[model samples]
Target: MHVPHHPAFPKAPRLPAASLPLALAIPLLLTACGQKPGEAGHGMMMPPTEVSIVTVTPKEVPIEFEYVGQIAGSREVEVRSRVSGLIEKRLFTEGNRIKAGQALYQIDPAPFAAQLAAAEADEAMAKARLAQAERDLTRLKPLIEAKATSQKEADDATSAVDIAKAALKAAEARRTAAKLDMDHAVVTAPMDGVIGKTLKEQGSLVSAQGDSLLATMAQTNPAHVQFGVAEAEQGRVQQELASGELKLADKGFNVKVLLSNGSVYRETGHLDFSDYKADPATGTYAARASLANPDGKLAPGQFVRVLLMGASRPAALVVPQRSVLEGPTGKYVYVVGKGKDGNPAAEPRPVVVGDWVRLDGEVKNGWVIKQGLKAGDQVIVDGVARIFMPGTPVKPVAAGAQSAPPAPAAKS
Candidate 1:
């Protein structure tokens, strides 16, 4: 009896041996399998994680391509001297508005006037010589016909008359040259616009392109705005130009200047020209627009932002950027799918992206799957990182989605 009892019972005491291991293992197993109140063994256990999210929405934002640019007016011209002379007097006010052909500077005309007087005196002397020669020839011709004068005498008189005529022609040419030189003494405005600072004042000798720029005039009546566009976008712009949809080409985009104080200008501009070739350095084609600047609101060398309308793509699929993941392959996003039980499940969707519109990316070829999502579907916009893992459970909350009771449907 002792031997039999000892064989089974001698291994360990009932509670002591088993209790130690049980106490140690029980807690660990419980902790490893522990979950929510009723989620044990249900695979609902989770680890803490962080997430980012974005929502899909449509907004009427301008299709804007932004670039840093300098403020430039339509008119810019450099005034230069047409002839070399001294700046005897500054007739126009510095930085004042001047019209074309308006007298701006006066050069001393004394030298030119003296040249003209000398030409006139030469002309009178030549005329007097011609008169004397004509009388000699007339008398010689009659005497020669009567044999009172020799043939040689009449021929000599004829030659003298020809010389006097030649002298008269030379004097007339000098007079015309002198008049042209006199006109150069007065510098006039080549274009009607505002004149810049006086580079040379009274008594300053300003030779052709010397250290002097008397003044500069820029025609501001209709000003210009120069800009560029990418070659890829040129086709769309050209199409808009041909169609009545845009009235003007890509440059024909309705341009409105926003001043420093955020005030809108009253005038509008039109596309004036487009370059035939693209710039090799930038690969953008040049374009220019003309705007009426009657009030001189637009100034040269100022910085401004341009808003342009591009080709519109209707029926475009879009998704918030936060939903997209940059995997080893490319950009992708998760879509919420419903299981047979209608419980939400997540599935990774690959998408081809296009121009970003605010926080959204234009999705193409992604519309093939119709059931999971739609254009206006409310996707996660915040806390996406917390739920971004494949098949990860999420406590979804919209950016502005507030907790509300589910609405009850009316009885049909």
Candidate 2:
């Protein structure tokens, strides 16, 4: 067959099947060679990442121990009836402040009054009988002296007078007891405090024997906060104090409370009591702090967060909490160090932490470094997320400093 070819057209060359893969890879290799040095996916070398750092230095850092506490009244008393009677009137309102000796409830006084009247009548009859006996004894004594009556008769009269006197004394004692019962018909508060809801209402029967609890009262002016210190934590604290690593305030711990809403309480307290023995179930020692709560802001049974201050760690290294990272092994932090080429690099350092503290000028709390970090170590505080691997080059910047823009991309 006869075919004509155009002058402007050109034929393509064919490649062997074995060489096809090599021909495809050659272009990719050439493209890879054209990439800039130190670029990602081309070489191990990478540009330095900018990060904010904090230079750790040993200093006296204040230590605060926090615990969950419950508010309580300094004195709690139960208002009870001293006499058995029906509650006629409730003198005080429920959930109100009351003064010492204030009338809480009025029992039915009619029964007590009747008993008192009967005792008085008995006493009157005994007094009349004693008068009559004494008159007879006087007459018998004169007759015995004049020999008109026998001496034995006079002796009998004397014995009768003595019996009447004894009866009169017994009646007076009964009268006094009846009067006391009458006075006790009015139930009074034992101390100045805030009263709770009355357990016994009007027309409720109360007795002095057992069922006499009318209401409860609590003294809230000086509120007490009760908390527990774990046995392990207590032991560690003692060891630190003994080793001179921690020092306590001369006057003891100053306590402050945080409300549930994250607000600080106005009044501060002092540690007043600590139990000698630990609780078996919780493995903690009970402790208490006293504070003035004149406004009654702290109510009984309310929960609060207690901060124990006035203790400090001397010559301790600290780092921001956010800077610390958790790994498969344990907690660690990134520090600025010299790389193989003498440039700054991020180095992972394992750390053992102690108590937590809130330092000045820091928004978040910090951890006290017990080991693995020392003075003059520059820890990466901010831009921690930028670090992808250990020993990667990093540009350390002072915390809170603004970094200059990248020279407008070098005007490329």
Candidate 3:
């Protein structure tokens, strides 16, 4: 048989059976031991994850205490009828601002007027009697000196004159009282303020001692915010003040009022009043702040939030709230630290948190770390959830990037 050798088909050299198996196993061994060109030892190593971090810097932060408050008039006055009469007319409009001594209601003056006229008539009659008695005494004095009248008659005449004088004085006193009743028939505002709805309407019978309620007026220009603080907290504040740890401005404790609509009031207020003792039932101390409310924007009974300032936390360690995590045991945070190999790793750190600090009036950004954290520690703020386990390698980047710098520790 003639065998043709082609360029594409190369002839294989024949080998012994045992040696052939070894030759075939050589390629298998090389394929099993060799690594791909792009691959490194073992396998490709993943790069550290990029994360946002906030550096913990201890600084002086203002300690702000917020309490729910109720708005009220600085001065509240209850309008009442001073004399009994029929309400003739409502002099002031409801919900209108009124001035002190402004007429609020007109009561019927017919009865009071009649009483004054009767008193005047009595006074007139008493004066006529007094004049007659005086003329009699004048006649008696001359008669007694002339011996035409008995001494007892002169004495009786003098006594009658004195009695007449006393009666006239009593009549005058009654007239004055009647005049006062007439004046009091008209109810007036006690202080300048907005008047509430009329309690006694027209044609209703009102009296000074009976059902005298007419209306209510409140001075709103300088509004008051009433709030209560836990007695324990107040005691702590007082202790701090005594220790000279907290200092107040010349005007005293400054207060900020936050409206229910989440807007801050323009004018600040001052703490003017505080109850001497804590309420036994509530365990709180009552307090009040006076704020300027010329525009009448703050209404009585309006709910608000009052923030007390002027105290500070010295060297407070604060971090962004986003860096905190809730675990099975308690709250924890990831701190950027060097791992075993000197690579940056996320280390789980337990921390005790304090009150929240609002960076802007609208949103809360950072919170106080009372324990387990110190100054100059890099805390992972963003990309915390990306880390599945502690000691995971990470690349730290500053938070807020170019848009905003790290949130500063708030003073108040």
List per-candidate RMSD values in Å.
13.1, 11.8, 14.9
**Model 2, residue 68: what's the lDDT?**
99
Q: What's model 1's overall lDDT?
A: 0.63
Off by over 4 Å in 3: 1-44, 131-161, 235-251, 359-362, 398-412
lDDT top scorer: 2
Candidate 3 residue pairs in clash (backbone atoms < 3 Å): none
Superposed model 1: Cα runs more than 4 Å off:
1-67, 71-77, 82-84, 138-152, 208-212, 230-264, 278-284, 314-353, 356-412
- Per-model TM-score on C-alpha atoms: 0.60, 0.78, 0.79
Candidates' lDDT values, in order?
A: 0.63, 0.89, 0.85
lDDT of 3 at 312: 72
Q: Across residues 1-412, which tens digit of lDDT does each residue of candidate 3 receive?
A: 4445422222445788989888777566555768443344452456687799889997776678899999999989889888988999998889999988888888999999999999999999999999999998987777788999888898899999999999999999999999999999888888889999988889999868879988888899899999999988888888976876545555667999999889999999989999999899999999999999999999999999999877776667888877787766678888999988899998888888986876455577778898888888999998876776667799898887733444787698
The number of clashing residue pairs in model 2 is 0
Model 1 Cα lDDT, one tens digit per residue, 1-412: 2322321112323468757887677557766765333344643444322233334544333243443334464565666665567778888887677888888888888887888899889999999999999999987776788899777888899999999999999998998888877887888888788888888877887676565466677776776666788888887657844663323334335665556665555787655677999999998888776778888777666556554444343334455555555655555566554544465545455556654554335322122121334565545445654453444454444555555555787799
- Report the lDDT of model 2 for residue 269: 91
